[model samples]
Structures are given as C-alpha cells and as structure tokens.
Target: MQTIKNLVKDNMRQYGMFIALLLIMLLFQILTSGILLKPLNLTNLILQNSYILVLAIGMIIVIITGHIDLSVGSIAAFVGAVSAIMIVNMHLPPFLAVILSLIIGALIGAWQGFWIAYMRIPAFIVTLAGMLLFRGLTMVVLKGQSIAPFPTSFQKISSGFIPDIFGTESIHLTTIIIGIILSFLLTFLEVRKRNQQTKNGLEVINNGLFFAKLIAMVTVILIFSYVLASYEGIPNILILLLALIIFYTFIMKKTVIGRHIYAVGGNEKAATLSGVKSKRVTFWVFVNMGVLSALSGLIFAARLNAATPKAGNLFELDAIAASFIGGASAYGGIGTVPGAIIGGLVMGVMNNGMSLLGLGIDWQQAIKGLVLLLAVGFDIYNKNKSS
Candidate 1:
C-alpha cells in the first residue's frame, strides 16, 4: 500500500495532464458522436496546431524565468510582413528573405532583452511597449494590405508532407520504419535513463513502473503513426517541430544553460549570487522566443500562402495561455517543454474538434477559456496543497 501510494504521488504530475487529455477526447468524442477521433480528422488536428505548439514551447521557457513576452504576436506579424515584402516587392529569394526575417526577429529580441535583462525593466512593460511598436510597424510595412501568392517553395513549409523515397501514395514506408525505430529508441533511452538514475543514487521509480510508462508512450506513438500513415504521409512541419523539441529538450534537460534558467526562475537573486549570468540567459531566452516567433510566422504565412499584418493577431494570448495551462507558474520557476507541448495540443485539439462539430466561434472561444481556467486553477490547487 505504501509503495502504491508513493508511486501515485510521484507519478501524479505525469498522469494528470494525460488524464485531462483523455477525458477531453472522451467528452468531445461522445458529444460529437465519435467524429472527433476519425483518423483523417485527427491528423488534421496535428497539422493545425503545429505553429501554436512551436510558440508554446518557447513561451514555456520565458514564463519559467519569471517573465513573459507580450510582443510575440505582433513580432511574428511584423517579421512575416517583412518576409512577404522582400519576396513580392523587392523580388528577393524566398529562402534569403526567410533568413533575413529571422535575423530581424533576433534583433527584436535583443532590443527587448536588453531592456529586461540589462536595464532591469519589467518584462511585461518592455514587451507591451514592443507589442504596440511592432503592430504599427507591421501595418506600415504591409501598407494595410495583404501579400499573396508566396513562392511555392515557401508555401511548402506548412502544406507539404514528407515524400516517400519508395514513391508510393498509400503511406510512406520510410515514415513507418522511422516510427518503429523511434519507439524502440525512445524505450531504450528511458530504460537507460532510469538505470543511470539508480546508479547515481538518485530517487528513481521502480523498474516495473518505469517500463509501464515506456510502454504507454510507445504505444501511443505507434497508434498515432498508424493513423497518420493510413492517410497522408508524415508532415515535414511536424518532423521539423519534433526535431526542435528534441534539440531543445536536450538543452533544457542536460545543459548548464538549462539549469541556470531554472535556477534563475526559482530565485533570481540566489541564482545571481551563485554566479549565473542571469542577463545572458534572459537575453537568449528572448532571442529564442524571437526566432521561434519568426518560424511560426513563416509557417502560418506558408500555410495560407499569404502574409497580412493581422495574420498572428492575438497569438500571444494563445502562447501565454498554453504556457500557463501546461503548468507554468505566473510567479515563474516552473514549466516543461513537454507540458507546453501538451497544453498547446489541448488547445489545438479543442479548436479543431469544435470546428469539426460546426460550433460557432464565440462558443469555441468560451469553451477554450473555460479549459484554460480549469487548467490553471488545478495547477494552483496542486501547488497550494503541496506547500
């Protein structure tokens, strides 16, 4: 009994979000009479949420540092507009424009980061000012007009799927093969990680419990692959996003920079006293946010094959809400990439499901708001109970 209780306590955080996701799907699936889980529709869910998921991953890091960036939406719009202008008017190469747009995004981050990190201005104020500044700039750059018919090469960023070397349309055999390998790789890594933890005398869960989680994870992945493989081939955007997740996850989980971020979030003064370059960390976080924002802008632009000053309106809200819903503390010092991904996906799936059901936008907005509230409220309740 004690072992079971302890295991439950240790596993609660991991299971809570999973349970919420399942409950959501069940409720929506039942209400919609099983329309939400159709394989093709579910695949659509992944494609739609791809951009927000990317933003949420970056937003999670920002919130974890006891800060927020309110200018992401405007920055994305502004950068996207710039990319569009370069291509449509200036006749710049699409790929070159993409690079230049990203550089501009980095510059925007440097501007805001300088204020927050070096001058010690509050992040909210800095980013808010940025929001207004960039909004106006985007409008001016776009001339209050939309740019359309972006290069097919650029449009493929969001609309394209991975092509099979085998040249078949049913499904990419390569994708299936890759999926199988990934599952096994993931399982192997988890086992090795748990064993390493044991060797290091760290508090590690029992082998059986860990293996159970491994099985659960791989099973879900396989099921998802089966669904997507049954329809279109793997999405390249999804693959790119997954690569970003893996790279960033490693940085956060294994690198000193990641440790410093958490340390600063936990207590900035303490972290500074411990010799962390808090300013640099904060600066880089913004830089990263800027880069990801640009990437999202491009994805959205590509998906639509158009760029408008209003393309990413209110997206900051989505990113911020995703972070908080995924267990980011408004007070900082808490969040994870996986949590952010899950949170973003929850919002994404909700929107997709509602759209599939032909629900009005207003009702969809309300439902999303309620879910956000519940998530944050549960987070607070959990924190209070633990404390």
Candidate 2:
C-alpha cells in the first residue's frame, strides 16, 4: 500500500494531466452530442493537429535547452514556399524537392545557431529577427499568391492512409492488428525495464500497480485503434508521428546526447564545467528544430495542396502553447516528447470541439488563451509547492 501510494505521489503531475485530458474530452464529447469523438471527427482531429504536433516536438526540445524559436512558423512557411517554387515552377521531382527543402532548413538552422551559440546573441532577439526575416522571404517567394496542385505523390505525405492488406470490407483489420501488436510490445518493454531496474538495485514499481498501468495502456490503444479502423486504415501521418514519438522518447530517456541537453538546459555554466559541450548541444538542437519545422511545412503544404504566403501564421504560438501545456518548464530542463504530443492533442480537440459547436473565432481564441494561462499557472504552482 505504501509503495503504491509513493508511486502515485511521485507521478501526480502525469496522472493529473491524464485525468484533465480525459475530462476535457468527456466534456466536449457531451457538448458536441458525441460528435467530438465520432470516427470521422477523430481522423480529422489527427490530420488537423499533425503540423502542430511536429512543431511541438521540436519546440519542446528548444524550451528544454532554455531557448525559444519564434521563427518556426515563418521557417515552415518559408520552406513550403521554397518547395512550391522547386516543384511547381522548376518542375523538379517531388522527392528531390522535399530533400532540398529539408537541407535548406538545416542551413537556416546553422545560420541562426552561429549567432546564438557562437556569437552569444540572446535567443529571443535572434529568433524574433528570424520570424520577420523568414516571413518576408516567404512573401517574396510566393509573390502574395498561393501555389497549388502539388504532385499526387507529395500529397500522400499528409492525406494518405495505409493500404489495407486484409481486404476486410467492413473494417480495417490491419490497423487493429497493428494496435494489438503495439500494446503487447509496449507492455513487454515496460516489464523488461522494471526487471532491469530491479537487477541494478534501483527502485521499482509494485507489481500490482505496474500491471494495472499496463492494462490501462492496452485498453486505450485498443479503443483508439477501433476508432481509426472504423473510419479508415491508419493515416500515413499517424505512423510518422508514432515513429517520431518513440524515437525522441528513446533519445531523451536513454542516450548520452539527451542527458547533455538536459544538463545544459538545467545550468549552462555547470554543464560546461562538466565537459558537456553546451554550445554544440544548443547548436544541434536548433538544427533538429529546423528539420522538424521544415517537415511540418511540407506536411502542411501537402495537406492544403498549396503553398501560400500566409501559411503557418501563428504556428509558433500553437507549438509553444503545446510545449508549456505539456508541462515544459519555462526555465527549461524539464519536458517529454509524449507530453508535448498530448498537449497538442488537447489543443486540437478543443479547436475541433468548439468549431463543431459553431463558436466564433474570437471566442475560440479567448478560451485558448485562458487554457494556456491556467496550464502555465498550474505548472508554476506545482513547482513552488514541491520546493
């Protein structure tokens, strides 16, 4: 009993967030007369929020390192514009255009990193300049017009679904199978990790609580899979998102570089004294952010089937909000990729639910602002209380 109590105490924030998400979903689900979680709506929710989720993934890393990237939205817009020029005007291959766009994003990262890492400019000012600069460049490139009709292959990056292999006319069998496999695999990994911890004489969860958690996870995945199967097979972007989540979670929790990033974010001078190349870590983080931002740009453009000068407007805010709502510390050194994803989903669900209720844009904006404020306030309260 004591072990379970201690475990729950230690994980209060996570549990709280989980419950809050469920409550919000339930509230909206009721308000929308069950429209919020309908099969089609769920699929739309994923598509609508995919870009924000990608940006949140990168933005959390930036915040983790005690920095911010105001230019992500503009960078995404700029990259999308470039992709349009390459594929539409130059008639370049869609594949080549994507590769070049990502490379261009990396170059942009290097440009900003040189100032931030080596020249020691404040990140806020640097990225603020970047935001204006990229937005201007996007306008110049697009000439205040939208470019459209991208190649079909490129469109699949955002709008396609996995081909159903089982040929089940009524349901997507492949999606269900994949979900079951994932649930089992995740449970096995958790149990194995617990055994490893015990072997190393580290604290381990009580077996009963551990199994309970596993059961909860399995149930959620099965339900989610069912929802997707009822609509269409798993979306291509969903697979991309899952892969990114798994990869980043591993990097942040298990890798040397990940530790260094956290250390730098925690205390730059102390991390430097410990031989962690703080500058290098910061540089690579921005580079990673650039790549992700570019990827988001491509995905957004694909989904819209066009590149517009106004594309990605206010995207950075969504990503930042997601990071903070997901429990990223303003002071850095604390956040998780999965948490950011959940935060993005929360925002997405709210947007979808409110739209279904026919709320005005003004109301939506105001409500979102309040939600962001409360989320940050809650985090600050928890920090102070813990201290």
The collision pairs in model 2 are none
Please list the residue runs of candidate 1 whose C-alpha ends up more than 4 Å from where it truly belongs after superposition: none
- Which lDDT tens digits does candidate 1 get at residues 1-387? 677698778766656676778788888888888878777787678778888888898899999899999999998898888888898788899889989988998899889999999999999999999999999999998899999889888887898888778877776676777789999999888888888888999887676777788888898888778777777768878888899889888888899999999999999999999999999999999999999998888888888788897888988999998888777887788888888887887788788778877999999999889988887788788789989
As a TM-score, model 1 comes out at 0.95
Model 1, residue pairs in steric clash: none
RMSD of each: 1.6, 1.2
Best candidate per lDDT, number? 2
Q: Which ten residues in a row have the lowest lDDT in candidate 1?
A: 10-19
* lDDT to native, each model: 0.86, 0.93
Error of 2 at 15 (Å): 3.4
Worst window of 10 by summed lDDT in candidate 2: 11-20
Residue 187's C-alpha lDDT in candidate 2? 88
Compared with the true structure, the alpha-carbon lDDT of candidate 2 equals: 0.93
Off by over 4 Å in 2: 1-4
